[model samples]
Target: MPKMKTKSSAKKRFKITATGKIKAAAAGKRHGMIKRSNKFLRDARGTMVLSEPDAKIVKKFLPNGL
Candidate 1:
């Protein structure tokens, strides 16, 4: 059988942790920071683990966890 190819976009955006959970940058931090609250910005400073359902979807795009 041929090897499955990982999605290019997924490879760049998501990472599989040692425990297999998907880690990704928090959303809503890209722009319009003036309107966002300080607490929101502080909380979204680092990567976060994707929820179970969302992780499952991303897993398909990454056949080999990265």
Candidate 2:
């Protein structure tokens, strides 16, 4: 059988943590930041764990992880 290929885009955007959870960057920091508040920007900093339902979909692309 041929080797299963992983989704390249998903690999770059999503990360698998030591605890087996999907960690990703927070949204809303891409554009139009000129009008955004300092608090919003500050709080958005750093990574966050994806929700359970969403993580399930991402797991499909990382078949060899287990």
Candidate 3:
């Protein structure tokens, strides 16, 4: 059978962790930082693991481990 093609967008935006969870950049940090609170900025500093339900959907896009 032919190899399945992984979603290009997904590969760029999401990463599979060593334990198999999806890691993605935190949202809401693109602009308007002035209106955002210090806590929000601090919490959004790094990438976060996708929830179980969300991870399940992302898994389909990454059929082959990246």
Candidate 4:
């Protein structure tokens, strides 16, 4: 059988933590930061775990993650 391929985009946007959780960058901080509040920008400065349902789907794209 052929080797399963990893989704390039998912690989770029998601990371598998040491504990096996899907860690992703928070959204809304990608552009136009000057207009956003300081609090909002500060809050988006970290990674977030995907919900159980969403994680299930994401794991398919990252079998090694699960």
- lDDT for each of the candidates? 0.93, 0.89, 0.92, 0.86
Q: List runs of model 4 lying over 4 Å from the truth.
A: none
Candidate 1 per-residue lDDT, tens place, 1-66, comes to 998998999999999998999999999988899999999999999999999999999999998763
Candidate that beats the other on lDDT, 1 or 3, i.e. the better one: 1
lDDT of 2 by residue, 9-54 (tens): 8888899988899999989999999999999999889999999999
Report the Cα RMSD per candidate.
1.5, 1.5, 1.6, 1.5
Q: What 10-residue stretch in candidate 1 is worst by lDDT?
A: 57-66
Indicate the residue-level lDDT of 51 in model 1.
98
TM-score against truth, every candidate: 0.94, 0.85, 0.91, 0.82
lDDT of candidate model 3 versus the reference: 0.92
Worst 10 residues of 4 by lDDT: 57-66
How many clashes does the backbone of model 1 have? Answer: 0
lDDT of 2: 0.89
| Candidate 2 lDDT for residue 42 | 96
Candidate 4 residue 62 Cα shift, in angstroms, is: 1.3
Question: In terms of lDDT, which candidate is strongest?
Answer: 1
Residue pairs clashing in model 4 are none
- Write the residue-wise lDDT of candidate 3 on 1-66 in tens digits: 988899999999999998999999999999999999999999999899999999999999997653
Ranking by lDDT: 1, 3, 2, 4
For model 4, residues 4-45, the per-residue Cα lDDT tens digits are 889999999999888887898998987899999999988888
The window of 10 residues in a row where model 3 has the poorest summed lDDT is 57-66
